[model samples]
Target: MENYYVFIMMCILLILLPGPDTAIAIKNTISIGKTGGLQTMLGTCCALLIHTSAAVLGLSAIIVKSAILFSIFKYVGAVYLIYLGIKTLWGLRNKEVAVTDERKDEDKYGSKSCFKQGFLTNLLNPKVAVFFLTFLPQFVNPGQDTFLPFLLMGATYTGLTALWFIFYIYLLNQISAFMKRPRTQKVFEGITGIVLIGFGMKLALEKAQH
Candidate 1:
């Protein structure tokens, strides 16, 4: 159907748009390697799946209606983003000093840590819940069974997301040699740090729709 085609196109465009996920993917891939990036991507996709399930079950509807609940998730998400930004910037300072193996191990996020960062970054963001609630239902025909359509669309979105991130991670890896230079890493990390903080502040200021 034409509507389905449009939906797929929209999904593709949205997937390509830059966001915290992209920033983290780029950060992890450059810092830890492709494996880290994939782990982060997996975490994010899992979060997306949960959001989809929540949306289908009408859980997101409750969050939308309650301003208090909305704020709790929003602020938590925003605070976490800001925390990540600050941690990134702090790492820059640590670069100047000699780091022991133990310190290096601590500085370098392990797989589980990276995965958790990706999961929580996505899971805590209420806007994602909002998106699924508001964005996915428009194309469904009225009076039709909604469950199958929702699941299908959600799975499509998730698959598209994974594909896009895989390509993105590969692209980042391709130029990783240049990106790994000391000067370049410092500059890239600083910019991403600021971007994350900016996103967090912006999200904090976001108003919940009635």
Candidate 2:
């Protein structure tokens, strides 16, 4: 459908724009490697599914209606983003530290931790949920009297997320050798933290659309 293509194009443009999700992906990729980045992406995609379901089921409308509830989530998301930023920035001085020979043990911890981090980072952000609530409906034609369009939109969005993240993973893999340098990794983490905080701040200030 021509409308579907237009919707897809819009989604791609939105994804290409710099945002917390992209910043998180980059940060994870440079610090931990492709697996870490991919894991984070997977978590974000899972969050998207939850958001999509909320939107379709009308739960998001309830959230949007309750200013107190919405504000609570907004602040929580903001705090989490700021916490991540501070943590990353604080680690800047420790950049040159090498992965100890006990890296094998550390690696095990890192794998599970990375996956959780990825999932929680997106999951805890209520702004992302609100965003989908606001964003996805614009393309829907209520007159159609069919759910097929929404299904297509959801599939397209999921595919776009996967594709973009894959591209990020590939690019990060290519530069992973350089990223392994402690100083480089520190800078990368710092940037990621800052970007996430910025996104969080922006979300905190976002007013619910009427």
lDDT of 2 at 98: 60
Which RMSD does model 2 reach against the true structure? 2.3
Q: How many steric clashes does model 2 contain?
A: 0
Where is model 2 poorest over a 10-residue stretch in terms of lDDT? 97-106
Model 1, 72-109: lDDT tens digits are 99999999999998988888987757656634674565
* Model 1: how far residue 99 lies from native, Å: 4.8
- Write down the TM-score for model 2: 0.87
Give the whole-model CA lDDT for all candidates, comma-separated. Answer: 0.86, 0.73
Predicted structure with the largest TM-score when compared to the true one: 1
Candidate 2 lDDT over 1-210, as tens digits, reads: 237778889899987886777777787777767887888788778777776767667777777788877887777777777777777787676554564633564466655656666666676667666666676667777666434555567667878988999997888889888888866777788778788778778878878654
Full-model lDDT, candidate 2: 0.73
